[model samples]
Target chain A: MDAYFFPIIVTGAFAGIGIGLLGVFIVGMRMPFIGSCISHTAMVGAVYATLFNINPTLGALVLSMLGSAGVAFIPNNRKNLDANTGQAILLAFMMGLVFLAVGLEQDSRSEMLSLLWGNVLFAGWGTALTTGSLTVALMVFSLLFNKELKAILFSRSLAEATSMYTHLVYFLFLCFCGLILAVNLKAVGGLLIFSLLVCPAAAAYQICHGHKAVVLTSMLFGLLSTVIGFLMSYYLNLPTGACTVLVSTLIFAFTSFSRFVLNMND
Target chain B: MKNCVALSDILIKRGSHTILQIDQLTIHAGEFVGLLGPNGAGKTTFLKLCCGLIKPNRGNVRFQNQCISRIAPGRIAHFRKHIGYIPQQAEYHAHLPFTLREVVAMGRNALKPLFHALDKTDYEIVDSWIDKMGLADRGRQTFRSLSGGQQQKALIARAMVAEPQFLLLDEPGANLDPNWKKQLRETLDRLFNDCRITALLISHELDLIPSACQRLILLDQGRIVQDGPKAQVINSDFARQLFGRTITTPEKP
Candidate 1:
């Protein structure tokens, strides 16, 4: 592989692993919309950052954190505003801001466009390093706090009742999720990143029996999707983000189908 | 006996409508109290207030003489760990992947310090509770796969694994069959008679309350209408009016 190909491949791997692991928790929590909300919020940050001549990644990270914090702190009263409804409102608001920023920009919109439709092939050493560091931090945090995370995922009320520092853990988890999405936005693109966050973990859920099994399987599926997607993009000259999402979707489809076939036989 | 939980001048309102109101209520340590009320009488809300899940709009909920609301937000979890709380129904996503064993193991999470894993002894305690609840064979099964009664039993086991000083159960006997109900009653009796765990159990079905429960508190229209010994409360004209004449006065257990 060429020198440029190495960084591209490495970036894809890190993005795949990070997004995949985060997906299980997001989907398990029944908040799949949160991924979309945070990603779009990051896009708005990146867009505005470009307009103001600031580092788009830093802006994305800060805004995504703020967005996730809003979600985490908002009261989830069903009578007033539920979490999903809150996320939907945030998503709409972010979309509006992104468009406004884009319209205001006087410079070339290539960087902004690249963020919307990611190009992993153009990933440099900086992208690979950032993605790798984030992936490692996420993995470590997940491993170290496995029991607490599981408790929160199982039932936040029960976790709180049991005195498990649930609010702190949940806030930290959301922040990490925001950070990962923001960093990966340039390589994977905001529009299609949610697919990587949902499909691989969801595919693992179709076949895995236990929590640990589901997590490991999801990680493997994520790795497979990104690597295979990268190879396909190289050979077929397709969009990297679209290719990765398609691969992850196919994996999910295959697992769901296999599960159905097995159940039919039984 | 000292007060285990005390609610003074407590008032909980939702948009100007009072859900629960009390001037004074105290549950003594080692007391097995059964809370009886009609639907929307706010028994669940009462339990939530005691455990600091919900703050009262007006007054204080004190546990062991310290005000729960006054406790630092960071230390509230520590206080809650000493009290095991079982909601009427734990709302979790259908796709949550934890097995029954893992769910039960969560009881220990609050007791241990942060970053500390469950040790072998902790697992042993969890396993023992699982066996006690007759879920030994189903430990590895996904929690969602269990029947309603089985799931309730598993949650009970989860609460008991921590060996809490106080237990707050809300309609724990719901969805249980006669056999499982008897088992639950026996478990409560043992916890009261042997373990001396202070408990406040909420149940609509009078028979589901353990025979060991000595005190009964009746609620109606957001107020405490009756508080006395179980037999006295059951035989009161007000309780009879509320429960109807179908409930007959019984010999003391």
Candidate 2:
């Protein structure tokens, strides 16, 4: 294997694990759209940063935080707009900003295009370290707040009524999710990362019956998808992002089919 | 007895329409009260107000003499630690992978500090409640797999596992069959009579109310129409007109 491939593989692994863990919450909460929204918002930040000669990662981080905060704090009530509607508005606004930023760029749009369809082959030691660090942070947060997160996922209202500091926990979880997506936006294309953030978890839930089992299985599937997808892309000389998404979708399809067969047998 | 919850000049509005309007109401500590009203008569709204789940458009809801609305949003959970609220329908996603044990253990989450795991004693308490609710064999089953009545029992177990000082149940018996309803009544009776846990139970059917609940409050069109002893409220002209028939109070268990 080429030496440069080491960093790319490491980055893919970390990104896969981080997004796979986050997918459980996203899918459990029925907010898979959040992955798309945050990634696009991060794209807007990255393009504008490139246009202004600033650090695209920093811009992505800041704007994605803002997007997550909007989703977290939006009043979900009968009189006011709900969180899903708020997220849709944010997503549309971000999409518009991304296009405007792209149009305003005077330099070669290669960097911006690479972000839309990620090229993990260009990843370096720095990218691997950042992804690794963020993925570790997510793992620690999940461990520390496992019970609280479970309660919140079960029902935010019930968790709040039970005095679980639900708002704070949920806000923190969203902020972490935004941060993970922002850092991985460059390595995993904005267009394809939502699959990594949702598919593995969806597949895990298809076959797993308990929370711990589902989370662990999701992480395993995430790791397997990225590693296998990377090897396939390297051998076939295909787009790494598209290959990863295909692998993830296949895994989900396989799991769903297995679950269907088992239920039929029962 | 000290007042547990006091609502004064409480007015709750959704948009321009009024949902609940109560001038004054007090529930004393260690008292079991049954709340009765028609489907849009604001029973759930009243319970929500008492639990600080929603703020009223006017007036105060005092918990242990502290105004809940005046309490900061972050600090309201501190007050809620003493309350176990069971809504009519718990918002549960169909695919959530929580077991009955974990669902019951959530009650302990409120009492413990952040990041603290449920200890053996907590699990023991949860198990005892599970047994009491007659779900001893289904601890490992996913919450979604339970029948409607079984799920209700699990929720009741969840509420009771906390040993909360106050419980607010909304139509807890709505999905329960007669046998389970009888068990629920006995459980409520024991909790209220023996443990002295102040409780407000909302039910559309008068038969679901436990025998130990002495006070009854009747609501109609967002107003408190009757508040008194159970028999008095049931036999009142207003209740008779509301039910459109005479309702003989059920024999005490």
lDDT of each model, Cα atoms only? Answer: 0.85, 0.85
Work out the TM-score per prediction.
0.93, 0.93
| Candidate 2 CA-lDDT value | 0.85
lDDT of 2 by residue, A190-238 (tens): 7788889999999998888779998999988888888888878888988
Candidate 2 chain B has its poorest 10 consecutive residues by lDDT at: B87-96
- For all predictions, the C-alpha RMSD in Å is 2.5, 2.4
Interface root-mean-square deviation, candidate 2? 1.9
i-RMSD per candidate, Å:
2.2, 1.9
lDDT of 2 by residue, B1-253 (tens): 7999999998888879999999999999989999998788989888888999899989999999999977788888888988987766645563576788888888888988988888999999999999977899999998878877777778878888888888999998887778878777877887677678899999878878899999999999899999999989999998988888879776566
Model 2: residues with Cα > 4 Å off, grouped in runs: A78-80, A264-266, B175-183, B240-253
lDDT tens readout by residue for model 1, A1-266: 66768888888898899999999898888788899999998999898888889999999999999988977887644557777887888888888888788777768587788888887866889889989999999999998888899887877777877874788888899999899999999878888998899999999888887799989889889988998998888889898888999999999999999999888310
Segments in model 1 whose C-alpha atoms lie over 4 Å from true places = A76-78, A264-266, B177-183, B240-245, B248-253
